[model samples]
Target: MLKVNKLNKSFGENKVLNDISFELKSGEIGVLLGKSGTGKTTILRCINGLEEFDRGEITVDDISIKNVKDINKIRNKTGMVFQNFNLFPHMSVLENIIQAPISVAKISKEEAVNTAKKLLKLVDLEDKINSYPFELSGGQKQRVAIARACALTPKVLCFDEPTSALDAESIKKVINIINELKNKKIAILIITHDIGFANEIGDKIINI
Candidate 1:
């Protein structure tokens, strides 16, 4: 689903990503494993068009990232989950989940709420939709964040240190959701330091 050709990026005198090249097929879960500061997150950012690379090309399902005329396109097709949940604090759980789809995706509020409720159920957060982010636990918030991402129904998902800040139980819950995504044949790219989680969900591991 993605073809990255001769990707290279540098900053001043430092080169973060050096001639990095790879291809990810549809429905494949690819993992990038490396210690901190090895450019794993940078690679993810570049692929998402949040960071600009000096050279190379990224094509997703035949659409080049360069061809993107706006940020909304990149976001709609490629969803990202961060280590920190990045939830909108001012909004309620349901609003957080429905805002992007209703605003950016231009869907109706009723439709987005309907979709959000279904996603909350999928992530086992049906009862928590009425709560605020501060009212939920870290794990619950992350699960809600995942549900928010799924609200967009992207073709591919990118996770950056998804479970790094979670507790053991929370990690397990998040990983389970990720594994379910793998089973459902959603293209996923995970950047993690956890060896076991990498082994469990990654169909291919690229060490940076």
Candidate 2:
């Protein structure tokens, strides 16, 4: 579960997020909808501890981001999928997926690979396990990124502009993949300017 209460963030004299409040329960999809410069991505960054907020609180599975010591604790339980599909160009799909579990979670390589395979299959990227990032299409790369994020078995998943730079068919695939994750009871948070995409999958829509 994810909860953001009275959140506020600012860059010097410019305030970005103002009293942003929302709660996402297990198996629910929450979308933050707004145009560019509305601090949608900033909220996600604050939730993941990538950015320090000026005020308020973000609780992911009851672990508050406000606590300095618990930052890594919450981050381990959270996964983020960026807009550009941030995959390692030199690393193969299998390697990318297993990296976090092995390095951060301290899981064995054998176990991590097994989990990676399952996640790759979930994202329909099993066949591309040996392929490099450059060899895949945008949609394929996005799926790979999703598989990598899910490899950690995170409690909360955050996606930034998930449907960006994809065709209609690709968007449909993403929708299906997100729905599958939701069925598995992972709390999902997404920020996008696409109203149609939000309406299609979001259980709760928060406007900025």
**How many clashing residue pairs appear in each of the predictions shown?**
0, 0
Which residue runs of candidate 2 sit more than 4 Å off their true CA positions? Answer: 67-69
What candidate 1 gets wrong by more than 4 Å, as runs, is 67-73
* TM-score per candidate, chains pooled: 0.92, 0.96
TM-score of 2: 0.96
Worst 10 residues of 1 by lDDT: 65-74
Could you tell me the C-alpha RMSD of candidate 1 in Å? 1.8
Using TM-score, give the best candidate's number: 2
Tens-digit lDDT string for candidate 2 (1-208)? 9888999999999999899999999999999888789999998888777888888878888877664345786888889999998898889999999998999899999999999989888888888999999999999999999999898888899999998889999999999999999998999999878889999999999898
In candidate 1, list every pair of residues with a backbone clash: none
